[model samples]
Target: MALKRPLSQHAQIIFRAGVESVCGDRLIRDTVQFGPTEIWFAEHCVDRQAIDRIILVGAGKASGAMAVGMIERYQADAASAGLIQFAGHLNVPQGCERIPEHLSWPDDLTLFAARPAGVNEPTSLAIEGTDRILHWVSEATPRDLVVVLISGGGSALLVRPADGLTLADQLQVVRQLSGGGADITQLNTVRKHLSAVKGGRLAAACRHAPMISLVLSDVLGDPLDLIASGPTVADHSTPHDALEILNRFDPERSISSAVYECLNQAEQQMLAPEAMSNVTNLVIGNNAVAVDAAGIAAESLGYNHVMQSARRSEGTAEEVGRHLADMTVEMLRRDPSRHHQDALITGGEPVVRLIETSRRGKGGRNQQLVLAAYERLLELDTSEPIDFDRLVILSGGTDGEDGPTDAAGAWIDGEVHRRARHLSLNAADFLRRNDAYSFFEQAGGLLMTGPTGTNVCDIRISLVDRLN
Candidate 1:
């Protein structure tokens, strides 16, 4: 008989399987290819003979690996070597800017650090890099085949504040909106209005060049126009849309005066959405892909798995966490030890409305989520004592960084809860202050995986052990 692995180990394996499936480099290899006759971008094919230059520009965490994959793909096809010139720029988070030594890292293609390692906001470096990309794209002609690699974090990684609005002003608007509980779409709607390069402007600048955008979606339902603020896809949203979101979030009229001025200008200056450039946007990977991959991994691990990838927002982090905890409880109620096959996998982006307090603790959405789940277990109203030894429940960001913390997210089990009880920690106290990282630190369940080099939002796993 085989020794059954720990349920925690099984849960991680399933989660990692999902992350690895939609890895930027792996997705690039799977979706892009070079041929002697033509180049393939997903289902679309382009005649190689007609293209003279391949301009590569991207912004996001996964772009470095995508650049590496592009280089590898180009190398693998010895037949097409040196037939066309390849050059461009990429704006990535700090650590993702560097390529592995194993690949032929080219000088012509620039990989720039757009933001600090832990901070996920637009920075001066991001603006400079965006400048380079705009310049590079503007230089492209009809002979150039432009490829834009877009993924999560691209919105912050790619930034050029609109005229008359300083970076601080734009950042302030975003900060106010985020603290007010604005969803990703609403936030990005505002982002598109505040930026010079975002919202299809990047592609529109090089309207003469045929552009292909490879999108790795972190947003729910893969709305191409909203992902990474839709640099390559046209924005159908009006400036009125942005102002409406601001008014909804900041009803007190506290947003920067410059932001309001900029939006008013954009309403008059911005062209009709239909008048923008034509670019083919291809969604190469997303949360659904990750969720499906995780289900396969569970099946391979000999567990009966059920999967769900959220098509819409799943509400607050605490709410989603409690739901997962309830799911685990319902599954446990069925007494799965006799059958030995129960695994639940879910994927989606959850909102984290930060508590406004100077005493607030540090944590990302994933950590907050798991902490909520732990609280739910403690609150369960059951006559019989719940079994803690046979369960593993976890949530983590696919990019391996959750919120502003170093942790990808966090996990919880009966053993971890016991440790918390022994430490005399109050989960509710921490939960109210938005500090799950502190609770998990003392409880021994913080999931720390630095920068997975890919982002497809978040994945959660629930696993139960089998009787041998």
Candidate 2:
């Protein structure tokens, strides 16, 4: 008899390994090209004669680094040109300013301060400084090309209320939609309509000036409008769309007073002479690039497997897990003479909404995904007699962190739950509390990769091979 190899087991390991490799510092550097400083120099010096001045204004998570990079390049180039004494220093990019501290206006010209801890951390932006970021963007002028260096957090950071809206009103709307389980597209649709810079309004500001946008997209499909709320891109969202999202997901929450007024004002502006005229935005990088880079590494390592489905995935984390699990089993059964070294990879972000009264558990979406796959595997075992020992299921966030948990994600064999039972921890109980972190820790299934600077949604890889 030919040897019977476990297809799922190998697939799981290969996928996890791919994700870890891509999320590392090395890959991140190769993938997200054009440091802020580098782009600044390139953009400014592109046509020294035609463009009188290369004004640089950088923003987003990478702004600090981008500014620094641009400044260095400018200094080097000016030195080569024999211009010994340029007006600006070389240590930092000229025209690039550090992100301003949070500025909230209480009166016409008076402002209040609300700087919090973890100012640059993910949760910190989600909590504070969102509106301030928008105010800064809104302050840009027509003399500027408005080169926006956008990354993942741009959406939250580019927080501005539509005309007549207060910071509190914007925050309330954002909190309700985000906390209510609205998907990214839907959440951004609302964000675009409620902001001065988002959804092409910022682009509209420079109706007569040239504009260039270099975006590092965190959205699954690299949707331009959704990334950083599409500040430099035209918005397809309308006030109606924004209202629809709020009504569909958060009808109970009263619209903040500021929010209501902003919507009303935007209605009038749509009738204005110029809404979208001088905006050109480009998504220079995204999760797909990361996924492709990871896939290439896998192929180079001799995996030699074509991705089964590269389509961006949606729905809940559990649903994605169930679907992936079923797909893995189906692939193994259908391809009898399949090659010994084949794998399947998929990338996308999945949503997980917590109920109001339900306490969030320790794990992020990745752990939950693995758990869901395990349940599907168990169902398969119970419904019919089959060998599952060789199969593996793996899922993880590409950012290397999930839902405040120490572990990035998990890897599991068919015996995962069985082993968990052996350790006296109920798999279902842990999952019920949204605590995949505990379950995986006990089962020795958690995978850790600290602080992968790149954010590329989620990556799922499955490897299956026939026995020799």
Candidate 3:
């Protein structure tokens, strides 16, 4: 018999495979190709002869890498370089600005730091970056073409307040909504109403110029109108929708008069502006792509894998974690008369509801989810004693970020679980205080990968031995 590899190592490989499949740097080039006189997005082509310039404008964690891909195309394709000029701006979190060692930071295309690393909220710098993008789009003529690279984190990276609202008011409202456990759709509905650029407004800014938005979807079911607040896609939601969501989260209406007033005023404006048809919004990558690739990786590693991607919000982090734990127990206790290994891969984003307490500690949704799973594993009762030696579970953010922490996510196996028990760690205590990072740090199951150059929600892997 061949010696088996560590399940932890296998989980990391599968997770990384998922990230690479949707990597912005690779996805962008794969979607667009230079064919003599045309640039292709799948089958749709833009004529190089008619283009005076190629304007790039975007904001998100993956946009920086997509921008690099564009630059690479410009350098490698003689048709693109000779026929069109490239100029524009991108709003990205810090560390995303790192480019290949061989490439110099070009003057024409600016990759602005919209917000600092680890912070997921809108900042003053984000507002500045948004303005520059708007200006660049405004400068484009009918002869020029615009390519907008969008991905997850664009909501925080691209910021513009509606009339009567300051950045602080917008931030407070969003934070409160998130803390209240509102899903991305509800949160983005509010954000779109509060922004001058989101909800098809960015497409409206294109005016007469031809625009194309390549989106890497992070929202469930790849809802283009909700991902990054749909800056290029038409808004199907209304200000009333935004108001209702806000009310659900904050019945007291303590989000300040400015927020409500802005929503009321937004009713006068059209939801999908007339210029919405001018832009073509394409979902170039999504969670399913990552999940499918992860399954393939699992199969290659001598495991039989099944995959799923949630089409809607899977509820709170704890709920999803517990569900995953239940799945793991079933797998661990399954009949394995046949000689094989079993693996399950899933992708979707889960919410983390913060409890208001001075004793709260630091952690993200992935960490919280893993901790909950750990606790569930300890509490479950099996007909026979569960042998977890060959079982492993992991949940990670494809963007290499989970909330405000440096770690991407976490993993758990028999060895790590035994370690936790040996240390007399109470998983429930860490979970209640929302401090999974501290628990995992000592328990030895934290998965840290600074930034993986992609974003497509979250991917979770569960592996078990099904040996004869």
Candidate 4:
């Protein structure tokens, strides 16, 4: 059964199909398999007799599913090898195990509910979980195989403050950087310097053990050292880089004194070079994976699909929205015959620079983008001869959570302006207040999808259909 709303139903189907394509479980299954004499994963093969133990240590929004996938793959091989001993410790967002149809793993793997589901901030609980993971990694020997699952949100899910820093201090720094609109790279640079587990420290703890990190990339460009703050990968960023980001984004210097001191100390005593001789980091899933899947799905629905590379998804939310709307208008004009269906798919996370207001409103980056697009469409000259009903635009966070709102994102068509007028709502006023949630709620445009158990950033789609 489809959702009663036609536009929403179509958008939901396309987006869900895209997300499912890069799910940790599916990626793991495709990358790992067991042969009669060797265990094969990606391009690497391990002789069954050469490994003494399998140790699983990871933290992220998708790590739980990744852990489950690994366990299932190995369990299937247990009958041939006779009881493969494995111990796992993973830090996952709370309630991840509750995802519908999520597979259950063996009792040997211990799952830690690190951060509260839907909230991306680090907490004391996440710190404890990171400690446990570190302990497990430290116990690994050269004969053991260490598998690390790193994905989006791992930075927060596996929180461990550096020496002389408290969790509260780190939280304050994160809150400031996030509210000030610092990009992922900037935020992670600061986080890596201030954390005990990030910036390849986790890899250092593994000592001489052979380690493989299967990562789901949420950062644009799929920078291995930036995803999840690169806990198991070598970091190229320096302490001065973190200090620069903090100073540039936090002009007021309102960051706690302890954080300032930490950065200052880090400038002189930065983390040592990571040992990479024994580590292999593989990016198994990324925004491109999801975007390509979405393009295929759109084509299957009889739409001519054009995809924007994952790198093109960057920019401010409003600017990105206007760009998509303008692109749609141009496409319709070129196809005056209106005899074909077209879909444009894009992937990347856009920033939302919150406006300063006495009263703050609720909304996320995706909602803001759709709202801005609606406004841009309304301002287009009527002489453009574009039929609004035949076009629909959607932007959503692939993780099923956008910003601080429960909604993944929002969708809009030509009718949004008329509906807003009937309600006597000024779209500009809502946009100024950064309250796309209320505007969409009244206009029937919000797209709500609870935690999707994965994160690869955001996806946007614009569909134009032939006039009837």
- TM-score versus the correct structure, for each prediction: 0.96, 0.73, 0.96, 0.93
Residues 1-468, model 2: lDDT tens digits: 222554444554555555444332233233223322333322332323333333333334433333333334444455343321111110111112232243221121111122221132223333244444334334544433444555555565555456676667666776677556677788888888777667776566554445566566667677787886887776666888777787787666577756756665676555232455544455555566656655775576556455532345488888988888887677566555545455567777787665454675677788888887777766786776444454566777665667666666887764565577588766667666777888888777786764343455677776554444
- Write down the lDDT that model 2 would get: 0.56
**What lDDT would candidate 4 get against the real structure?**
0.81
Stretches of candidate 1 above 4 Å error? 1-4, 80-82, 273-275, 381-383, 466-468
Q: Choose the strongest candidate by lDDT.
A: 3
Q: Give the lowest summed-lDDT range of ten residues in model 3.
A: 381-390
In terms of lDDT, model 1 sits at: 0.86
Error of 2 at 177 (Å): 2.8
What is candidate 2's TM-score against the reference? 0.73
TM-score between model 1 and native: 0.96
Q: Considering only N, C-alpha and C atoms within 3 Å, which residue pairs clash in candidate 3? A: none
Per-residue CA lDDT of model 3 for 1-468, tens digit only, reads 222668889999999999999999899888887656778886678987788888999999899999998777666775544755688999999999877877654668888887878889999999999999999998789899999999999999989898778999989998899888888988998999999899988888888799989998999898899999999988888899999999899998789898998888888887545677778888999999999999999999988778999999899999999999899888877777653588989988889989885887888899999889878887784445666666788999999888888999998887788888899999999999889988888889889888777899999999988562
* 140 Cα displacement, candidate 2 (Å): 6.4
